[model samples]
Target: MIGSLGLKLARFAVVLSVFALWEVLSRTGMVNPRLLPSASDTIAMLGQLLQRASVRSDLAVTASEVAVAFVLAVPCGALIGFAIAENRYFAEVAKPLLFFAFSIPKSIFLPMFILVFGVGFSQKVGFAFFSTIFIVIMSTTVAVDSVKTEYLTVARSYGATTAQTAFRVYLPSMLPVLLETVRISMIFNLTGVLLAEMYASRDGIGHQIATWGENFQMEQLLAGVLMIAIIAMTFNELVRWVETRCSHWRT
Candidate 1:
């Protein structure tokens, strides 16, 4: 426990040092304040931005897109992944293709999404789903594979039906790993929504950040980025906490 706490503190110190350096550079004119605002100033601007209804709307739009995408992606990915993994032949044939697709940059398909969905909310949500589903599928496959063969054999010896074995043996074993995938899926979903909004849409936090950059509003741009970082970190920690709780049996 002490070692873990110490490691966390060390990470916090590194982040604090980076912020301090940024502040000093901006305040001392080592870096132009107009281009690289102090961390405090950027945080202040974030507070101001939050007070604006438009900024709040943009945040909500992005959040909703990410939520929708996550909802669509997780179950579909899990089912498909489980199906593939359950069949040895199919797994061998498809794993390579899936890995190749995962390696390709999803950004290149943004133009196609824009063309089909017209830079609307649907486009953002669809793109986010597309971006997140592959990772979730990959993770789910691994989670399924992690289940012990002994568990399955025991279930069969007990005369368990297929559905019973799935629920009694596979699910309990996979839950911990699947929970970990939730964190990864959220990250990919959030990134996909932000990228879609930045590339084409007009009414998301990503779009607003892009606008600020185009207008050379460095404070607002940095503030927007900070807001995203905070939000992402919060979700990541929340998912991590849940993962830890669910996986306590492992310990």
Candidate 2:
């Protein structure tokens, strides 16, 4: 544990070193201060936003949207994936359709979603769901396909029922990989929600950032950007921790 903590600290030190270099360069005019504010200035801006009630409210709304999208996505994606896995015919029938949907650019759907779901939370959820579904579906399908036939044969040899093979062999086999896919899809959904909010929102972190940018309030803009990076980083770290725990069985 001590050794693990040391490695984590060392990694953080490297990150801080890079930020320190950027701060020095920006402060000394080696880099354009206007274009690249020092880390200290960005941190001060972040502090200001954290103190404000409005930013907190905006963050809560955005978080709620993200959570909702994720909740809706996981079960649906898993079901589609599981269906395809259970039968080769269904896989062939569905794979092309799913691919076509994924291939279409997400931005193109914004107008349609707005038309259907309107400029509200429904639209945001739709955008987030659209952005992430394909990743989870495709990943889950691949994981299912990769399950060895030998395992199925062994189960059958032992007189395992179809349901038993699916539950004991197939489901357990896919859980870790499916979870990894979900983590990646979550990241994709987060980006989708933020971009959707930026496009059309009365209250969200993305909306606040856009508002600040429009007013050329560099400090506030920087603050919002910093907050986003922090949030994204937090998600990444949590996913990585879960991935590490889940994948230990693989080796």
Candidate 3:
């Protein structure tokens, strides 16, 4: 307990130190204030931005896109991954292709998505889904493969049916790893949505940030980045807590 508390304190101290450094550098003229706004100014700007109806709407739109993409990606990826892992021939043929696709920069496909879906909510969601699904598929495949052959053998010895073995043996074994995959996939999904929004869309938190940068609005730009950082960190921590809770299922 003490160790955990100390670790939390250390993380908090690190974040506080970063903000302190930002404040000092900007206020003391060590860095140009126009380029790097003071932490206080950025926070103030974020507060003001949050109060605006348009900014709030943009935040909502981005959130919706992320949520929809995640919902669509997880089940589809898991099913595809499980199917591939269960078939040796398919695994040999598809794993390399999936890895090659995953290695490619997903941003390159944004224009194709735009051409198909236009610069709208569907485009952002589709791009996000495309970016996120590959990682989830790879992770799920690994998780399914990690299940022990002995467990399956024992289930077979007991005359367990395929469905029974899947539920009793595979599900328990894969749950923890799948939980971790969920956390990682969300990061990809959020990034894809933001990149789509930034690249083409007229309205979204990402678009707002891009606009602020293009207009040389340093304070707004920094504030927008800080807002995204906060959201990402908070969601990561929440998923991590759930992962920790589910980790006991791992053998």
The runs of at least 3 residues in candidate 2 whose Cα sits more than 4 Å from the true structure, single-residue gaps closed, are: 1-14, 159-163
Q: What C-alpha root-mean-square deviation, in Å, does candidate 3 show against the real structure? A: 1.7
Per-residue lDDT of candidate 3, residues 99-154 (tens digit): 99999999999999999999899999999999999999999999999999999999
lDDT per prediction? 0.94, 0.86, 0.95
The residue pairs found clashing in candidate 1 are none
Worst 10 residues of 2 by lDDT: 171-180
- Tens-place lDDT per residue, model 1, 71-111, is 99999999999989999999999999999999999999999
Which scores higher on lDDT, 2 or 3? 3
Q: Rank order by lDDT, top first?
A: 3, 1, 2
Ranked by TM-score, the better of candidates 1 and 2 is 1
Candidate number of the best TM-score: 1
Q: What's the TM for model 3?
A: 0.94
Candidate 2 matches the true fold with a TM-score of: 0.89
Each model's backbone clash number:
0, 0, 0
lDDT leader: 3
How big is the positional error of residue 167 in model 3, measured in Å on the Cα after superposition?
2.4
lDDT at 25 for candidate 3? 100
